[model samples]
Structures are given as structure tokens and as C-alpha cells.
Target: MKILNPAMRIIFLLSVLAFGIQACTNNAKEETSLKMLQNKVDSLNLFVQKMKPGLGELMTNIQLHHEKLWFAGTGLNWKLADFEIGEIKETVDQAKEIETDRPETKSLTMLSEPINAINHDIENQDINQFKKDYGILTQTCNTCHTANHFEFNVITIPSAPTVSDQDFKTLQVR
Candidate 1:
């Protein structure tokens, strides 16, 4: 008969625990990467909204994730319906249902859906109407916030940071 002694069993359990820990670590890393991409999206939107300019470099950075995020957002190579729209609706609906200190405005969610639509357009290389779409999304953010009593906390399109160190430019090999 095969048997695992206490010491062997403990070692085996520890190995499983180690693997669990590694998986959690990996998830955290991936989450951070996703947030970085979102932040860049926010930053670029701000720049565009304010007419601050400098999109070439920012776009180059956005392009770096062309495959990783911009495309994989759908979790598929090609699709008719915009996948990011589904994400926007899901997130906004969930956010609205949650009981927070303030009622849910879905300002950020509203604000980003149009932007994501633009991103979808960009990914398809259909550059004709992205800017108009983005403007509408930015307006949605402000309008939602004001209507929901979060006027004091109106979230604008994020711009070049005075505090954050995350770079949006595509990485360079040095």
C-alpha cells in the first residue's frame, strides 16, 4: 500500500500552498498591468479633451498594447458587437447596484464607454469618427456626476499627471 507519512504530507500541502500564493501574485501583477492600461487611457483622454496636444507619443504608447489589451478586450480576435461596450454596461450596472457612501452616478463608467467605442474604432483602423465619439463620452462623465449630486466630485478626463509616475509611452529597450 502507498502511504504518505506526516512529514511528507505536510511537505505536499506546503507545495500546494506555495502554488496558490504564486497564482495570487500573478493575478495581482495582471491587475496592475490592466490598471496601467486604463490609466493611460484616462491620461490620453484628458490631453485630448483639454487640447493639450502630444498625442503622437501617447498613441505610440497606446499602440504598444495593441494586441494585449486593445484587441484582447473582446477576448476574441474579431467580433461584430463591441466587447468593451459589454464591459461598460456590466461595470456600470454593478456599480449602480452597490451601496456606497454616495449614490452611484456611473460617471466614470459612462465617461469611458464612448472612449472604449472610440478605441474599438481605432483598433479597426476606422479613424473617421473617434474624436467625436470621445467628446460625447467625456461630456457624459460630467453630466452624470452633476445630475447625481456628485457635482463636487466631477471627474474630468485625466491629463498629464502632477503626481503619477506611470509612463504611457511604449517601452524601449535600452
Candidate 2:
């Protein structure tokens, strides 16, 4: 068996000690980086939690869009009707995402059929069909409200434009 001399033994021990120190330094750096990433994630989560809208707020937006849709359809403004329906669908989608914990969110699926029918009526540009489909949509909204124990919030066909500033009628280009 060959024995390492004194100088070689000291060199080997110092090399091992240096390697150990470098490994510890690398571990410390990794831990700091992980903690920084965790802090960023926590901050983003808090921001999103604060920005989330309540279910009632989303429903109120839907209600406004529903009224505007009625006016647009009755005025034979298919484009505007389509836009309103899109807005309603968007708000409903947002509700589904942000209000996942709410039981009422589960009833939102009931609106899909009626909404699709309304979109079909809009595409055909048939005011009569639009009115009928609009009625069905309103009824569906009320049905959802009833199922969610919010029966008092009944939705009905709008008798007049909710907003007077904007004309529901389509402007013809002369």
C-alpha cells in the first residue's frame, strides 16, 4: 500500500474543505432565491384576491346588459344586440371564474341555452324571433334566480331604454 506524504495529505484535506464551503454557499443562494420567488407569488395572490368581483356585482352588470339587449333587439339593431349578448356572456364567464365558491354560480349553466338561442335570433336578424328568445332568456334568468333562492330578483322584458343617452336604434349611413 502506498502512503500519501505529508504535503499531499494537507493538499487533499484543504481541497475537500474548499469544496464543502462552496457547496454550502450554493445552498444558501438557492434558499434565498426560493424565498424571493415565494414572496412574489404571495403578492400576486393578494392582488388577485382584492381585485375579484362579488357575484352580485357580476349579476348586476348582466342585468344592465340584458335590458340593453332587449332594447337593441326590439330596435332591429342586430349588431348592438349581438354586442350586448356578448357582454352578458363575458360577465357570466367572469362570474363563473371568480365566484367558484358560490353555490349560485352552479346555476349559471342554465343561461347557456337561452343565450345561444338569443344569439341565433340575432344572427338571423329576425326581430320576432329575437323578442321570443329574449323572453326565454329573461325567464331563464328568473329561473336561475329562483333556484339560487333569489326569487325576489325577478327579471322582465324592458319596457323602455334603461339609458337615455345612447339610442338603441341602428344609425343608417346615408
Candidate 3:
């Protein structure tokens, strides 16, 4: 093998050293970028954990909506009843999504039938059927609670409107 001249050897060594330095610099940059990305992901996870509502809070919202739904149906306000049912369904869906770890969430499926029944009654504008279906919905709620060992939290047909500011009756327009 032909021996490399001293100057050639120096140039070759310098080239290898330069390439090694560049590779190390790129590796360090990649590691820094990865750490920053991981930190961003951790921050988002923490924010979500803080913002997530508890199962009890979600159930309380459902209870309020349930009371409103009763008044709406009893007052023959089909539109309002429909809206209240929709809100209940939305809240139930949110509970299912956010409280996946809770066993009670699994029982939420039992509500779907009663909710759909009430919706059908509302669509038909059948006040009698709506009242009957509303009882069913309330009973279903109590059933779920009882099954979940929350029997003390009994749900019943509301005797009076909880909110005084809002009217359950449909507005009559001239």
C-alpha cells in the first residue's frame, strides 16, 4: 500500500474529525427536540386532567336536566322537552367518554331506551305518553343508581319547578 503523505494524512484526519463533530451536533439537536416535544405532550395531559369533570358533577347536571325535562313534558312543551332530553343525552355521552374508568358509566346504556322513548313521545306531541315515558326514564335513573350502590340517591318525578326564572310552557305568539 502506498503510504499517504503527511499533509494528505492530516487532511484525511481533519475530514473524519469534522464529520464526527457534525454527527454529534445533529444527535444532540435531535435529543433536545425530542425532549421539548415530550414536555409539550406532558403539559397537555396535565391540562386535560385538571379540566376533566368528575362523575358526581356530571350526574348532578343530569339530575337538573331531568327535573327540567319533567316540567317541560308535563306542561305540554314538546320543544322544551326535546331540548332537555337532548341535553341529558349529551351529558350522558360526556360522562361515558370522560368517566371511562368508573363502573357506573357502563350502566348508562340503560338510559338510552327511556330517552329514545321520551323523544318519540315528544315527536308525536303525546303528552300522556311523554309523562309515562318520563316516569320510565326517572325509574331507569334510580335503577342505575341502586345497581351502583347509590340507592340513597333516589330520583323521583319533580313536584315543582326548581328554577323560578324559566317558564316550562311554550310561548304563545300572536
How many backbone clashes does every candidate have?
0, 0, 0
| Residue ranges of candidate 1 with Cα displaced over 4 Å | 1-93, 100-116, 125-128, 171-174
Ranking 1 against 2 by lDDT, winner: 2
lDDT score of model 1? 0.51
In TM-score terms, candidate 2 sits at: 0.90
Predictions in order: lDDT: 0.51, 0.88, 0.91
lDDT of 1 at 79: 33
* Candidate 1 residue pairs in backbone clash: none
lDDT of 3 by residue, 80-149 (tens): 8899999999999999988988988988999999999999999998988888888899999889888889
Tens digits of per-residue lDDT, candidate 2, 1-174, equal 149888899998999999999999999999999999999999999998888888888988999999999888877878899999999999998898888889788778888999999899999998888888888888898888887788998989888877889888877621
**Model 2 spans with C-alpha error above 4 angstroms:** 1-3, 172-174
- Give the winner by lDDT: 3
TM-score for every candidate vs. truth?
0.35, 0.90, 0.91
Top-scoring candidate (TM-score):
3
Q: Model 3, 130: alpha-carbon shift in Å?
A: 0.9
